[model samples]
Target: MTDLFSSVALPGGFEEVEHTADWAYHIWAPDYVHLFLQAARGLYALLGAEWSPEPGTTRRVKLQGVDYESLLIAWLNELLFYRYGENLGFNQIDITHLAPTCLEATLGGSPITQWSKDIKAATYHNLAITPTDDGVEATIVLDV
Candidate 1:
């Protein structure tokens, strides 16, 4: 199926797609690090997150999964958990490595006081990350 982002260029981004029930997002980037960052931003955009002007303290995040898909899901879910559990709104993320089964990142952002929406989890439904001329792309389905 074609999406608004299906033919996007290098240094990619995300777009909302039509779905019967849950929210879906199509995201892409020029590389794995950018792909992960874009996915996080897309998920935050879906939440209608509002942020503070002061950037949050830099924090190290180390995650291990069974594969790239699992890593993606875990990475996104970890961000969501921060929002739900710590009230953070991340920005300026830097991923040092996003190997097939693990990722290490340093993120910067601030605490959130309010957000319009929240997600239940980062799902695996139809999740696939593939290489493109510009870079890698993936679609994420979230439980809202």
Candidate 2:
């Protein structure tokens, strides 16, 4: 199998794992969450796909967070930022920061022409993150 932390080609472009748990213990999960954010930010920088002010055009994204809901919100917010701020669309998301309460990721491709399906605010969908043997894992629920 391929290395989990190694750089891999994503839907947007490419991504690499900046850090991961080494099967050890830790005090709080937030510290690790920060690492994931940093990594994801790095990836976004590498992609070099800026916000395009087009209609129905998908663009790549790089956003970070400290919790599931926050992470999801951050992801969609970035899309919203592109949409309202620059009139762009968001499509695929490449999540490199896999943490229980944090996330770092890069997204690609959003339509600028197509209007948002619904204008809904971000909400906490009772998100949760948990530690696992392979590092950290969590499922973010977005109230859209």
> Which candidate has the highest lDDT of all?
1
Overall lDDT per candidate, in order of appearance: 0.82, 0.41
Query: Per-prediction TM-score, please?
Result: 0.88, 0.40
* Candidate 2 off by > 4 Å: 1-64, 116-120, 125-144
Q: For candidate 1, lDDT tens digit of each residue in 36-128?
A: 878887888788887877655667899999999999999999999888888887766778777998899887778876799868998999988
Candidate 2 residues 27-109, lDDT tens each?
Answer: 11233444333323332343333434554343444555665547655654565566568654433445565554555555445
Model 2 weakest 10-residue run by lDDT: 21-30
After superposition on all C-alphas, the RMSD of every candidate to the true structure, in Å, is 5.6, 12.2
The segments of candidate 1 whose C-alpha lies over 4 angstroms from its true place after superposition are 1-10
Q: Pick the candidate with the highest TM-score.
A: 1
